[model samples]
Target: MQLVFEVCEVADGNPVSTVRKVFDGVGGVIGRGSGCDWVIHDPSRLLSSHHGLVGCREGRYFLTDISSNGIGMAGSCERLRKGQARLIEDGDVFELGALSIRARLMEPVQPFGEQPVITGVPIPDDAFLALDPLQALDLEHQRQSTSDELEALSAGVGEPGAWADRHAADREQVAMPRRVEPANELPRVDSGALASPSDDVFWMEFAAALGLDLGKLDHVARKALAIKVARLFRLEVERLQHNRAYEEQVRLISTLHSDYPG
Candidate 1:
């Protein structure tokens, strides 16, 4: 079975270098000798290593404080104390300073009707038979006694006392909600002053009846129309000025010509 492992931090946007150093340390432990095929280490890029060798082994995966600071796996069942060998299982999370690495166990597939055989592995004869039942029972009794004591301590805690009530009252007296004034609304514009619907409707209907071909109207035509409109407006203003000047000149010339008549 190929295992999948991921390394991330509690804080977002951690540097790639920190992630790499973690993989390097993990690689050193499981990447030696024949285990090279079962371990991978790279931190520069994600998906850097392929195959099933990027994670740590179950029994062999151990944590150490090689870093200048220290590393810890928060919320772990085994309680990974400083420089301790905490056995890693599938879905186990370990924190190395800010870095957090999660392990996922992959299930191994077996062929049908094939009874699995355990061979050549170190096995001690009478390993299970060597247990002392009386000693085991004593340890179990001690565990139960400890659990009962914890429950009793938890049940004793109840509502706050007089001191807590006084503190709460003091805190309430110090703070109060401020008043929020109403905001001034903007004055509305008069709808009657705006252009009427009839004005727009007439122009729209006239434009529709003309069947204006928008595609046929290119940049040149638009430019030409704009120039013509500007020129016409300028000519009308010029014509008014010219008429006024001509009227003044004619009045003066008539007066002069009349005065000098032979």
Candidate 2:
């Protein structure tokens, strides 16, 4: 099974909320305890070091409460009692004291001993956008991992610079402004103006959204993320185009219905 964690907000610590991590493991821990798999470094006294345990077994995933203070689900104020294990559903939000996290079951596990096959299905750009923004950025980074120096401004915007969780200190500066803070709040974008798909301004804004500063990176480092930036831009442009096309079609249908009356 594919599991995804989106850090929606960071009430404390580094801005890890900008990150999205996917795992295909059998099980793991999410707590502040030293032995826990996912260690949380928060100053809140409400959280137990070992707050929760997560495991995939018997063909299903589950989360068990092991904290004394209790973990509360966002929509419901009900706090799970200690040793209460519940099946994890898609889009489940849990509040571990001050740290808030959302878990999603991304994909079901394929039965073992069965050969996997590729259907050659063409996935739409919107499908990717449905993913967590950080996840989308990461996938684009992987796809462009081997890209060399950029031949176009649209070619980059990734690499280890502004968006990268880990950035080198001495790379040449091409610093883009720091637009986003926590990374969860996306800024309003004018898709029509970004139709070029190869514009520097478009890429700069995108990198900013991803928590990357284009102006802070050195010339060499900026060249590194060229492909990913362009890829994200292209995807966004296509999504916008698709949206516009759909709107136009709807308007035309409405006009025809009014004038022709079926």
Candidate 3:
């Protein structure tokens, strides 16, 4: 049976749930013990070391609760015990101490939100391809096709002319980076000054401004995406905390621009 562990509750300092596959097979264990196939992470000290076991027999999924504390199952009045192997089906939610994960046969359902909570980013449908590194950075960065690069791929390659042109183009891009509007300049950092955009403290501040608790996020990539999305929200908001947040956002945008430049 396919199952996913959706974090219904997070303990203090717990990172947010990462999009990951915990188990593929039918048999597994859910406990605090290291030997268990799926180690239970309980911050409340509620679950015992050997808590529960999951297995499949006759194409039916079942869970055996062995902990001193009862294991709660959805739609069941009474909890399952060691002797009683509770039948698990799709939409089944299992509770082990403070953490409860919903089990399903497919991908975990996205949480409810007015704006789509984007967990995955699809490739651009424009089908834009990059032939060079600088061209990849800014698609609009106009350039003429080099003859040597073409010849190199086809036959004995072009002369030293091709290599020289490519090297020159790279230098030009660095010398004069195209900037956009007011946020063109990257946030400046000074010695012993306040936290800069590149510093970890800035991101922490950014998260706080956006109400993003880093401890609630588990995956690094998801944490990065959260920051990106939060900045996108910051760009649109007219007021924050009953006051104009525009000034703070300009500084925030400076940092954001440093990370993502056109």
Candidate 4:
């Protein structure tokens, strides 16, 4: 599948032409010329000192910042630090310097129980053909007229009356205060005050109860078991605290009673 990208300049708002320029430049670097099937660019060099990589790999596209400056991912568990390759997902927001790029993941539609087929269409030679001479002349005239109007407006501002008005406007704009929303507060945890058993101790007791040989299991499997046991214990404690009867509790109690034979 062809990797899709949406690019924009850091200083300007989303302009289609500017985005197209960056995409086209980067596409030439990796897509058409390089043997590599992916296109990745460090956009930081263009607008800011920050550096990042944007590319696709094995049907997945990602934008990661690995510069001295950092990139922030909105609502993410962790801020992507330098040299960190964060897996991009649909609607993922990446902030690099003053610019933000939002990833819009597009999945190819496949027939039920079927793999998606990639299509390659050849470009037509006529696509690059120039416009008629008269049409080109008219377009040039329009552009010159627009430029002249802009120059006239810029020249008019040099007048005393215009200069004074412009200065006052600039001052007023600077004097206006911007309103900002308060940051969302996180829950405060006092680690010193909380009494919680370590996972190692709990896992040892749980493994003893289950009669499992810890030495026989791999480290990954043991960690998985510890997590599962911890979750199960937490669920049982919550149920008992709420005075709820759970079948697992009854089964455990019956098993213990049978072992004791009392």
Candidate 5:
């Protein structure tokens, strides 16, 4: 199942910029922070870093207010306080911080979007063989010689695992893959900062928090999860950048970390 959240910036009773995100299974977070999927830039500082959540359960979509200031539901007299969740319907309008968002229910069919068609040149028959019989024989002999040489080299290398172990030191000498890096490379947040993009540890922490087994997920699932994580990271980064105070930044990290059950 999939759910769509069409978020629009409201200014003077008029809509400004709009962002649309389609969430799968687990749904996503809404906030002023960089780590949220639906990020609202609240200049009035009326929203929490991690404000609310929109998720689906048992085919029913619900909205949960996790923000300190609470969330306003359209046609409702009172605000939905922290920890309060309500079943929401399609076309429902809700207020978070300075922005307004509309909820939309979607069917599972073709939820993500249409895939591109990839066409390739077809290989012709006898493409690999030389046109002349004598030249073909010569080419066959050259291929055999190369195969034999590769087999000999393979035998000398012993088992693949053993060869890898032997060259471990040499591999270490090479530059690290451009993924995880030292915490120092990230924005300062007291003792540590939120992990930057491509950081393994940061992603691991996020996966753990979401009760996700990344190793068990297929490529498509992983890609979706990565997109969600990127949104969250962006939300957090925005929060840190918006709030220059060191103590406030540290508190923000502590708040988010403490909120995670895992």
Candidate 6:
């Protein structure tokens, strides 16, 4: 069994419509800082760099307040003082700064054939864009565990600013002037473009509507189609992190998968 935390919307604390992201391991710090286990990108800046720590004790989970602003229960007006700790149960919702998050214990399952595994080695910039999207899909699925994904991104991306450069370059080519706020709404993409959908269901539907047999496509053709899909997924994740779309990010990550026809 693993302890999972579902982060609700940043705009308003509510349950996520999709499966809640499940982070592996016992528990760790929750904050806006990159170093924290749970990195929350809060645009309002209400969350501290090192907000609080979620730790396991006596076979139960506990949240400790370590931030300057403090943490609180979902409906309570009171917040925990720095250094204070509270016992939390599965399905308990709490407030960390402005973000509302729910916690629950879940039995681990391999949604894909085997557990989703992300490679630790960094892919060069030239290769990052060219790498197969199906492989990228596998890595993205493995990202449901917050620590595993962040660690891979932080370490596997080689240098500090390389990831940003790659992202900026991709955006320069396809990004629009204004931003869209809807969680499920996809950005404006060329109709002729390949890999338009973020959800796997949409991918399947998209492939089916076009009467494309993904399994039969040549390697080069499949790679061409999947590259854009990979780019879309990566860009969407970056957008969510930057906008502090916590709920959307969680849903996107937890549900990301490409069920390629066998």
Most accurate candidate by TM-score: 5
Tell how far residue 128 is off in model 6, in angstroms.
54
Candidates in order have lDDT scores of 0.45, 0.63, 0.56, 0.49, 0.66, 0.63
RMSD of each candidate relative to the true structure: 35.3, 30.0, 24.8, 26.6, 17.3, 30.2
User: Candidate 5 residues 1-262, lDDT tens each?
Assistant: 5678877546445443336777776656777666676676666777687888765555566778877678887667767766656777878888876667787887877535585668797744544433467766765575577777676665434223444566678879999769765675665463223434655565567665554445544445666777876676676576567666877889989999999956
Name the regions of candidate 3 deviating beyond 4 angstroms.
Answer: 11-21, 74-77, 107-262
Write one digit per residue (lDDT tens) for candidate 1, span 83-192. 34445566767554344667654554557669687679563454334346885576557557767777566532322344345456777788677898967988776543
Candidate 2, poorest ten consecutive residues by summed lDDT: 158-167
Pairs that clash in candidate 1: 38-53, 73-95
Q: What TM-score does each of the candidates earn?
A: 0.24, 0.38, 0.36, 0.28, 0.43, 0.38
Per-residue C-alpha lDDT of model 3 across residues 1-262, encoded as one tens digit per residue:
4566566654354643342235443455566655555665565668665576665554455677767576886556767766467777777777666666676665434467755665775644333332356655443232235365654564422213445455566667775566756957788764435534575665567544433334333345435555545553453242233245666788899999999999
For residue 42, what is the lDDT in candidate 3?
A: 62
Best by lDDT: 5
lDDT of 2 by residue, 1-262 (tens): 6667676766666544234555464455566655555766666666675677675654456777867578888888677766767777888888887767888886655688676876886744443334577977776786677455442444445333333422344344658677776868778865543446566665577554433345544444555466534553465466569779999999999999999995
Q: How far is candidate 1 from the true structure (C-alpha RMSD, Å)?
A: 35.3
Residue 74's lDDT in candidate 5? 62
Query: Deviation in angstroms for 9 in model 6?
Result: 2.9
Cα lDDT, model 3, residue 61: 58
> How many residue pairs clash in model 4?
0
In model 2, state the lDDT of residue 180.
Answer: 70
3 versus 6: better TM-score goes to: 6
Give per-residue CA lDDT, model 6, range 178-215, as digits (tens): 97676986698644355445644554665543233354
| lDDT against true structure, model 6 | 0.63
Model 1: per-residue Cα lDDT at residue 37: 30
Pairs that collide, model 5: 33-235, 34-234, 34-235, 34-236, 35-232, 35-235, 35-236, 36-232
